[model samples]
Each structure stands twice: as C-alpha cells, then as structure tokens.
Target: MSEEKNEITLKNYQVKIQDGLLQHLAEFIKPLWQPKKIAVITDDNVGPLYVDKVEAQLIEMGHRVVILTVPAGETSKSWEQVQVLIDSLAQNNFVRSDGIVALGGGVVGDLAGFVASIYMRGISLIQIPTSLLAQVDSSVGGKTAIDLNAGKNMVGSFYQPNLVLIDPSTIQTLPKRMLVEGYGEIVKCAALVGGSFWEIVQKVHQPADIILQAESLIHASIAFKASVVMRDEKENGLRKLLNFGHTLGHALELIEDGQLMHGEAVAVGMAYITAAFEKKGMTAAGTTAEITARLAQVGLPLVANQLGSAAFYRAMLHDKKIKGDQIILVYIKKIGEPAFYPLKITELKKWFEPILNSQIEDN
Candidate 1:
C-alpha cells in the first residue's frame, strides 16, 4: 500500500500507517515536548527483536531511556503483572511526569498503557505498535484493559496515547498464522463499515493473494476503526459497531478457555451472527454463505464445536454489551452501517442450537 493511502483521519486521533512513519519519530515525539524520563515497556516476545532499535532511536534523539521487559502475550495484561510493573517503576525512582513507550503487539500495548493510565492517576503513553494486530486495531484507541479468567479484558481503562508511532517495517516479521489471525478484526471492520474496502478484503482472502499486500488491508482496517473510535471514544454508541462479530466471538473464546485465538473465534462468531441475521430475515439471501466461505478461505473456521452455544451464551451474559443480563448485541443492519440490538436471552437462545451444531461440524 502507498504511504499516502495509509493516512487515516480519525474523529480526533491521527493514525498514520505509512512506511516511513519512524523516519519522523523525532518529529512525532517532539509534540509531547521533553519529559523528565521515558520508559520503553515491551514484552519478552518483542523486546529481543526490536527493543534495541526502538530504544536506540529514542536515545539518539536525546531522550533518557529505561527499558522494562515483561513476559510476552496475554498474561502480561493482568493486575498482578501490572502491579509488578508499577512497583518496578517506583523502585527505579521513575516520576509520574515521565512518559511510557509501548513497543509490541496488543498485549504489550494494553498492559503498558494501562500502567501509564493509573500511575499517579495519569501519564503520557506512546504506542509504537509492531504487530499488524496492534497497528490495525488495539494500538490507537485509549481503550486499555487486562484479561480476567472469567472474561477477557474484564478490567481496564480508556487512556488515549500522546503519540502513535507505526512502522510497516516492523510488520514484516509477523508470523503467518498470527498475521492471518489479525485479519479477523479487519474483516469485522469491513463487514460492519468497510464500504469499498470490502472489495479489496474479498480479494485478499483468495489463496492466490500475496501476503506482502498487507499494508493495504492494514490501512483500511485502521481507517475503519479510526472513524468509529472518533465518534464514540467512550464506546457509548457508534464504536460498538466495531464489535459486530465480537459478541459471540468473545463468548467462544471464553468457552474454549483460552484455546482459541481472538481472531479465530471472531471468524466463527461473525458467521453465527450473520446466520442469525439471515434467519431473522434481515440479511441478503447469500450473505451468510458468502461470509462463511470467505472466512473458511482465509483458514478461519465458520464453526467451532469446541464448546456448545449454551456455554457460550452463559459467557455472553457477562459481556460489557449485556444490559444487566440481556444481550444488547452489536449487529449489522447492513454493510458499513451498524446497529445495537437489545436481544432477549430467550430470543438469542433460539439461534444457538443450530449455530452450535454447525460450529461442531466445522471443528
């Protein structure tokens, strides 16, 4: 994708996904002005690979750097680990006025930014997202959270970043499976509000599509999210649409008990939701099949029999979208336009039987 095309205009945040974003890192950070000190928070998975480069870039620009490394992945997003990070900073005599730089995928970004949010009540957070998943979805939003065993992202905060530093060069090293996993959210964005971007998405799913063409997809997904987050930074309304496939998708993840990746479950979840929409006579006749087939083509299953829909529904009750105990789902009225529905538990239960069975068969 052309660097020019990756310039995304969010409601308030500026999300730049171009190739040379790092070339102007100094300029980007300049806006934040000088800080007493800066901490580069990363995870085990990412620290060894890109930490030196990121840290060196900052130091060369005359910033005091402290590197904090956490164990990689989701576990890092826990209150326990967060406390450890806080204690570490305190022990190191870091001040509240200092800023933090998060340089990894979603887990690192979420955990680090979250620490910055509560540390001394609030501080600056700079997101230098390396993974495609973070660049396209989690990195920019002030929405930060840690996972709970009962539910993913059960505890968190919404603290916007002071600056977002994206470098497509970092995405080149992403594993193929992880890369494919990241696309689930992008597809969710497309299904909900992609507009003409969906045409490109459909092509990308083809087995013949080249992986190197990811910049185009990444930019489109970011643009989609940028629009939503801008309208509803607090997630009161419009931003909920981005959860189109996430309701059931998240439930499936809980049901599997960390067995399925976020994106994989979302793939199945989107299929199930589209199916329900078709059953309600709300969707185009072929939409369900087309959606399922596309997910399948991309190696994401339409059905996951790992856990029954009954178990899944139980998990749904705990979702943030649930009103008390009822499911107020984020569903698509049509592509590019989203609707939030207050669905009765009983009403949703009706569709689970078939969706559950279908998921089993797919698995």
Candidate 2:
C-alpha cells in the first residue's frame, strides 16, 4: 500500500508490483499476450484462495483457462509432478501459441515455468508469484527447475517469463512462518548489495516489521535481482554473486530432507560459510557476526548443528557451480561487497572441518 504500484523493466520482461494486481490480471495480460488458452498452474493451497478468481478474469476475457493444481510443498517440485503438468498441458491441446500462468509460490513458479519452457518447445510464461519468496527472488530471475534426488534445482532452465505480476496484498494471507521464509532471500539480497537496502533491512527487528514494509522491501529485492539478471542472464560472471548462500544452502536442504525451508537453509548456509571464510582470512573481519546478527533478527536459523560436515560435502559435489575440481563460493568482503572464490573440492572439507566439528561438540 506504500506506493500502490511500481514497475521494474528488465531486459526481456517487466515486473509489475501492485497492490491489487490479482484483480486486474486480465487487464495486464491483454497488453502482453493474447494466447488462445492460458494454463493457470497452482497448488491446492493457493487454488482454493485465488485460482477461481484468476480463472474467472481470464474467462471473462474469452480466453480458455485451465486450472492445474499440484500438492502444496517442496515435494511438488519433482520429475513426477513435472511430467504430470506436462501431460495436463498436452492433453488440453496446448500449443506453442498458448501461455502459462504460474499462480502460486516458488514451487508453483518453478514447476510451471519449467513446463512452459518445454511444452511445445516453449510457450509464453507469465509469473504471478503470491508468496514473498517468489515475489522477491525466484519469480523475477526466470530460473525454473525441479529437484532431483541428488540436489535442488538439478533439472531446470533459464527460461524467463514474459511478465512477472506481484501482488503484495496477497502476502497478508501467508502465515508468519511463510513470511519469515521470504525474509531469508530478502536479507540475502540486502547483504549482497550492501547500500541503502542493507540499512533498511538491518533495522527490521521481526517478521511483522517486514510485513509493514512489504511493498518497498519486495520492490527493492526484485530490483536488485533484476539488475543482476540483466547483467548476467546466463549467470556467466557477475550473476554468480547471487548464489551467495545457495551452494551450501542447497546441500543443507538436501541433508535435512525438506525439514528446512529454502530460505532458512540458505540463511544457515550464509552464516556458516561467512564464519568459516572469515576465519580463513577470506572474508572481512566482523562480516560473519554482522550477517549472523541480521539473520537472527529475522528469526532465520544460523546453523544446522545436527547435520555432519561430510553429508554437506557429498551434497555440494552435486552442486551446479562445481567446475572441474573446484566449487565456486560467494563470500562477503563485507556487507554490500560480495566476491566469489572457487575453492578446490579437495580443500573444501579442510576449510569447513573446524566449524562442523565445533557444531557437533556444542550439541
């Protein structure tokens, strides 16, 4: 409600953050795309809340709308689900000219986006990210994927959406835990950028504070990611910085078996890696403590003390960032100044040994 509406233009698409964008879905889609059919992919949880309204708007426009609902959770991001969605699209007689509307959280966005990318060798994609996690991070980036047993986002594509429509008001429906899940990514963005954004984020003492400032915070997070995506669409160089906590975060996610939310896992990854790198003289002094304090302020976990170091290492080996014998890790020289360091796979265990051991001893 702060601004009511704001727009950020990216290279291939535009992100529209509006207070009641959901009600105006048809108005927005008319200008961008006019497919014969629009497949609205969502989850059971969100379908009951928003899909009927979305379908009604699309139908009012004389466009055929199909509602495909998956179960609500990370498990929905799988090959099985992907195939199910793909079959749904095909069975509905979807074609290259048809479009897809991903109408839920990150899981829905990624799964539906992946389907949109491959169905008929790619169709139009419009992302309507309802959750904070999707609005701030995943929805804008165009990175679509389904998890493999080996790792997160193992099977995916850099398929950008034609438009990203964010409704901040929808976040009011999210539970406190889901809202905090989003802060993980928002804090990650602030730590990476290290300017006014970081200052604004640092002052937030709790999840309620973020909700009060949701509009501005969501816009800032999306704008930062849009800039990075524009500069490095393929994540070739500078874009790698966006993976700040993702390397070990994905590993921790795999180890916990979905016990941790993506943002929570990444929060722990960012804290632990920064601490380890600071000890090795790779990160700036106090950077670890600063990042830790900010994460804790938002109620994000700082470490997975119960998990062992070896499990993380094994999981990290499957990381996409691994090239040859080294895996690229992003570290903060300080808040707002992020740098990438590619540590040899052989040396990874040695680097994290003390931190892992101490965590076990403390337990």
Candidate 3:
C-alpha cells in the first residue's frame, strides 16, 4: 500500500503524518521552513538512536544543525531544564531564523516547542515525533509547556508548529513499557473517537502490535485531534474534550513523582473518572467497567490508592484546569464521545475517595 499522508490545516500551518517520513527529512522540511540552521533537541535515550541520523541528513542537505540532548524522562520537562535549553541556544549563537526540531517523545516535544515559541519572540517549529504518544497527541497540538513544582504543565503556551512530521516506523525502537504508555494515549483517543477506530482497538491487547497495525489508527487519531484543535486552537472551548482522563491523570502523576508515565497515569484517570461519572449519573451505565477492562487488558493501573485519596486530592488542586472554585472535568458519554463537567474543588475528595480506595479492594 502507498504511504499514508494527512494534512491538518489550521489558520497558520499543517500537520503531516506518513510512515517512514523521517528518512526523507531533507525533502519534508524543504517546503515548510527551509532553514539555514536547525536545533534538534532530543533526550539522551533517543539521541543515540535517531538524532545523529537526522543531523547527518540535514548536513548533507547543506543546512547547519545543532544537536542538544537532555537526560531522558519526565523530569526534563521542568522550568530549570527550559532555562538550560534557552542558555544553550543563546550560547550557540542561534538566531530568530534558526528553527527547532523536537525529536523525542512528549517531554522533548513540549520543552523544545516551548523554547521555539519564546526564542526571539517566536520561530519555526518542526515536530519529528518519534514516540507513539508524541506522534499521536502532544506533537500535533502545539501546546508547549514546562512543569513547575506545583503542577504538571503549570506553564504552557498554545504555539502551533510550522509543520509536524509523523513517522510511524520510528516506534519500532521504543521499549515495551514506552509502547504501553503510548497505548494509554491511544486508548484515550479511541475512547473519545469511537466507531471503526474503537472497533480496531478492541482486537489488539499488546502495544508491540500497534506498530504493525498503526497506519489507519494513527491517521484517524491525528485527524480527530486536528479537527478539534482547528476549531479551538487555544483550547478555550472544544479542545478540552481531549482531556478525558487527564485531570485526575495529571494529579496521579504529580503525586507519584515520575513513577507513573503520562500514559499510565492517564489510564488510571480514565478508569477512575469513568467510575466516578457513572456513579453521579453523568455517564452511561457500564461506562466505567468498559473503560476499566480496556485499560486492565493493556496492563495499566486502575487504582490510585498507592498515594492515598487525600494526597491525590491535594495534588489535584494544583492542576491548571482548576478555576477558582470549580475544575473542568472531561467525562466519556460513550466510547467515542466526551463531555465536560465542572466540579467544585471542595467536592473532589468525596467523588474521588471510592475510586482511590478501590486499590485496597483490588489487593
């Protein structure tokens, strides 16, 4: 079959998804932002595998390339790392015309994209997302951010990339856990986009198999995201639906302190929140059980009692989604659709206690 290509046109630019597109980096970027200089920011784990290949290709095409690598994992998304990256960019004599290429997972994509958004006020950003999570979600939206000690993505901006290149073949290099983490996001997308996509997801139980079967799923997920983002680029409206499991997910991640990957945390959030919503009569009957089973089949944690419900609730108060007295919560109406429900901060513990306490029953 021919390579899959998708173009998502926003008011400013487009997102392109194609298999093995990274090999043609030169040609792919030539039409977007033909830069004299490019800063390829990646993490240590990914740098050894793909960054050099990208650098060599860019050099062969006669463009100046600078490769910068930070320690891998979620910690790299801190404000301190962002400062270090900025200082490095300045020290390298990078100018406004130079572009940034985010070549890792969501962490690198968020950090590098945030850097590009602020450097010289703004510059071109080309996302060559390697990880499945980055490829399917973070890389497409242009919502760049760094974490503060207070919360995940405490600081962020809605900066769109000039172009996004999704190369599904790159996912083959990911670790099993990483792939499973990506599956968490994929499950989120499938649950939100229901229809043929959900049907396709129902058959697979392993993350490794997704690479072999990702062609249509990746395209569909990105297409769905693009449509939502195009309608609400700043996330002031419809885009919030995409946060289905993210509210409590972010809280669990913060409470766990790097033990939980983004996808894993979101998986728990999906299950617990679905249960909570069902209990409140907000979601359809059995929605919780359906989501919990899907998440459990993928080996995701379904309970958050590891940190205790009180602490989890405390951590949640730090989420940026909180608005004064009420926080915006995203809940699934069914497998393919989602709706937002804002809840008072004071009532969070009452709602979250049973789900967090489920861990005791599970044990």
Candidate 4:
C-alpha cells in the first residue's frame, strides 16, 4: 500500500504521521534541529527492538547521537529517572541548542519530555513515539509529566515538542496486551470526536486488523488532539475535555499499582463515569450501555475492584485534577459530545455512588 502522510499544525509546532517515517529519520531531523548532540531516551523493552536501526540512521547522517535506556513500564516515570537523565545529560553537556528525542512509549515520552522541558529551562524535543498508545495520544500534545508518589502526572509541564514523528510500523512488534491498551486510547479519542472514526472503532476487533489499520486510527486521533491543543495550548478550556475517562481512571491505576494498565483503567473509568453521567442526566440515556458494550467487545475492563471503592476514592483525592476542595471532571453527553463539570471533592463519593457501589460488590 501507499504511504500516508498526515499533518497536524499546532501553535508552536507540528505532528507528522506517516508509514516508513523512521527510515528517513535524518531527513526529518535536519530541518527541525541541527545540533552537536542528540539524546535518545528510550526503554529497555523498545530499545532492543528498534533503537539500533534508529541509532544507525542518525549516525549515517553524521549526527552524534547519545542513547539512554530506562527500565520498561510506569515505574520508570519518576523523579528518580528524571534525575538520572539530567545527570547523564549534564555529564554529556546537552545544551540549549541540542535536542532530545523520545523514542519509546508514553512512559519514555513523558519522562524525556519532562527532561527536555526542565533541563536548562527548556530545549527542543522530537517525539518518535513507538507504541500505539504514545502514537495516538501522548506524543502529539505537549503535556509532559512524571508521576509523583501521590498521583499520576502530578509534577510536569505544558511543554510542547518541536516536532512529533510517528511511525505506525513500529507497532508491528508490540505485544498483544500493549496493543489493546492502545485501543483504549483510540476508543477514548473516537468517543470524544465521534464521526466516521467512531464508526470505525465500533467494528474493529482482532489485533492483526488493528495493526493493519493503525495508521488511519492514529492519524485521526492526532488530528483531533492537535486541534484541541492549538485552541487551548495550556489546557485552560477545551483541552479539559480530553480527560473524559481519565479522572477516575487515574485513581484506579494508582490503586491497582501495576495490575491495571492506563487504558484498561480508563476503559473502566469511561464505563463507570458514563453510567453516573447518565443517572445525572448529564449524558445521553443509553451512553453508558453503548460505551461499555463496545469496550467490552474489545476486551477492556468495565469494572475495577482490586482496591475497592473507598480506596479508589481516597486515591482520587490526591489526583492532579483535584483543585483544593473541588475536582474538575469531564462528562459525556453522548459520543462526540463531552463537557466539563466541577464538583466538590468531598461530594465525589456520594455523586458516584452507583459506580462505586458496584466496585464495592466486586471487591
């Protein structure tokens, strides 16, 4: 098949998505930034699979490249890892003119992006997101962050990248579970934007099919995210809608520790929150059933009971979305229509009783 090149222009930069983009890394990098050094931050999981090829490509173009690999998974997204990266950069003398490349999944993107944002106040960043989750969602927006002991993405910045390069071909080697986690983000994006994309998601099943059709889905998601980020780059308004299932989803992820993947938790969050939104007349009457059924069909979780409702609620109190006593929440009116609702944090437990009650029973 022919290659697909899709562009998303933001206020400060652009996201370029295409097949076979990785092979031409030098061509893409030269215009974005010409530097004495390039720090490629990736993970052990991804580094072994794809880093050598990427490193060779950069070196062939006569660019000096530094490769740094962290352990794979969420645990790597921490202050400790950030310090390790900073020390390495300092020792290697990464200056303002130099650029950092995020060459892994969301964990690497967020960690490296945060490193780019804070090192010497700020530096140019090029995101080469490999996993499906990072390609469709995290890589495009400049929402760089590292999780704290208290919450996910609690300490970070709204630092946008100089360029985002996505190659859907990288996902061919991803584990089945990781790809399903990516589908969660894809479904979340479709629910938010709703149209032909939503229709496409409803019919997709099997991993091989998703990989075959990855480019289109990822391109559509980046386009939607880029539009929102361009309008509200700092997430003051329209950007908040992107948190549709994330509020509760984040809480569950923290509580479950490593058991629940981000997408799986959010799938449960979407299902649970949609039910609550329906009960409150905030969402379409059948929104919950429709959303949950589709997610279930795709094998994402509809309930999280590993830590029970009370613990989940307690964890949510520490979420970044909680502003003092009030928490900012995104609610769905239906597919393609989402709105923000601020509620007192103390009232969250009572307001989401039905969803929480179900989790209580499951626990």
User: Which candidate has the top score in lDDT?
Assistant: 2
User: How many residue pairs clash per model?
Assistant: 0, 1, 1, 0
Q: After TM-score superposition, what is the CA distance of residue 204 in candidate 2 from its true location, in Å?
A: 1.0
The Cα local distance difference test for each model comes to: 0.76, 0.86, 0.81, 0.84
Best-matching candidate per TM-score? 2
Residues 1-363, candidate 4: write the lDDT tens digits: 112357777777778888898888877777766546889999999999888998888777677899999999898989899999999999998888888889999999999999999999998888999999999878977889998788788889989898889888989888888888898888888999888989878777666768877878898888888778778887778988888889889889998987899988888888888888888788887777777766776677787675346788898888666677899989879999888889998788789885556531110
Model 1 clash pairs are none
Candidate 2 has its poorest 10 consecutive residues by lDDT at 354-363
Those runs of model 3 whose alpha carbons end farther than 4 Å from true positions after fitting are: 1-5, 358-363
Candidate 3, residue 222: CA error in Å? 1.1
lDDT of 2 by residue, 1-363 (tens): 122249898887888998988988877888877647988999999999999899998998888988899999988999899899898888998989989999999999999999999888899999999999999989987899998777788899989899999999999999888899898999899999988998888778888888888988898898889888888899898989889998889888898887888999888888877878887887788787787777787778877844455677788899888899999999898899899898999998888887666541111
* Candidate 1 positional error at 147, Å: 1.4
Better of 2 and 4 by TM-score: 2
Answer with 1 or 4, whichever has the higher TM-score: 4
Candidate 3 per-residue lDDT over residues 1-363, each given as its tens digit: 112356656556666777778888777777666648888999999899888789998888777888889999878988788889889889988889888888999999999999899988887888888888898889877799888888888887889898888888888888878877887888898899889988877777665567777776678788888788878888788988888899888888988878898989999888878877777787898777777666777677776555455678788888767788999999988788788889999888777776555542121
Model 3 residue 312 CA deviation (Å) reads 0.7
Q: Quote model 1's TM-score.
A: 0.92
**Ranking, TM-score, top scorer first:** 2, 4, 3, 1
- lDDT for model 2, on a 0 to 1 scale? 0.86
